[model samples]
Target: MKLRDELNNREGYQEIIEFYTSSINEYEQEIELLLEYEKKGIQKYSNPNLEIIKSTKEELRNAYYKILKSMYSKGDTIEGILAIYLKLISYFTETWKKSNGYVQMLEMLSIGIMLKIGDKDFKLLIEAVKKDDPQDLLIDTLISYRDENWKQLSGKLMWNKPYKALQEVIFLAKEDKNLSLERLHKYLKKEWFRGAVEIQTHKSKFNIHSGYWSFESGALVKILELDDATLKDQQYYPYDMVHYKE
Candidate 1:
């Protein structure tokens, strides 16, 4: 495993991992406290306070996802990365059930699919994604992998962004595998990092600069079963994750 050169500060990355770990623990403890209060029939921490509990759990899962990305940036083993990913999924599923198909981030849906989660979990992801109404063809195409009858979603994405590259790659995948690979290579080189300036520049306390990964690209590769020989070295392609095996 090699550390992403973009994340040059190994010490800073470790610090981020530690910070999120601590934040996750705090959020967990806060949830436990909230539950205890609810169980005791406290007026303020009544059923209505479930929203607070839900929010805390959301924060906890966000921290877990951050750790997963940071650990990958730190060059952790695939097994280790998968372990944290599974934990995050478990948390996500619990919250989704409670919130009636809530999805915290659209990107997470693609990541979960590419990770090769079980069919039942994938179904939950599909439902949550549909509920979120992503309105993007790329996400709809992704869902079409599981539900072949899934209709094409309607909307236009801002063409100037990096996602346009991904959208082109997805369209090309249906026509020419070679062309798709070429487009994906171009995406990794030019468009990927340019789209995420905040993380690249480390502008905020919340941004905990993790490794840059194009999970959508990884998902498309897995779905299309494309030869990623040319993409293995691409900066944001997440090649190992696309090829990860249990």
Candidate 2:
């Protein structure tokens, strides 16, 4: 098969990564604007509506999808696409979870920012992302309706799978005295929320959950790493990681 054909045949993280890293150049301006807007406080785009933001996201998503389609069809390198996709996903995740005076907006933004899944979740979300499942149906309906109660809806929508995953780990830490509520809020602000915001455990199952928004992908649709090293190598360590005990 030709190179483009090969790329076309690929899917999930591999394909997404390929499109993102390779397409970063096209999105450089968008990245800069997003950054500037965040720094300036969206003063120019003042009444930030959920629909408008979702529309913008959809437009960009389609653009990337189209580019991937065209490129892969033409036999091109899928390299470099992943990085760009990761960055844009991060931006969207961060922007979506901010508090702009709306309650439901705040909740949906929070859960979506902290969305996760185990191995099964990774596969399911990845397929949905690829357009096979009705995830579009759920997230689209939520964004279209844009209600305050949608956060609960999100929990039901993801079937409380990833939510429980996060809640389980964090609750364990909280009860164990490894984290705080404010720190938990920090995790909610993330694009790829983890539990290591202020602490890390010694277990291999899950050592740390991050409270920062990842300028990378969300959706635990797949398990990436299964080791304490992820926490050990964290660039920023919270006090609970090694300083305290219950």
RMSD of 1: 3.7
Give each model's whole-structure lDDT.
Answer: 0.71, 0.33
Which candidate number maximizes TM-score? Answer: 1
- What clash count does candidate 2 reach? 28
**Residue pairs with backbone atoms closer than 3 Å in model 1 (clashes):** none
Clash totals for all candidate models: 0, 28
lDDT of 2 by residue, 62-170 (tens): 4454443344333344343333233334334333321321222222222332332123322332333333223322343323232333332232233232233344433
Residue 46 displacement (Å), model 1: 12
Off by over 4 Å in 2: 1-42, 46-54, 78-246
Candidate 1: tens digits of C-alpha lDDT, residues 1-246: 567535446776788789998998888888788788788876464456578888888787778887887887777777787778777876775565423332234456667766777777667767765555646666676777877767776545523376777777777878998999888888878877777443444655454677677777778888787899888778777777777782
Report the Cα lDDT for candidate 2: 0.33
- 73 in model 1: Cα distance from truth in Å? 0.9
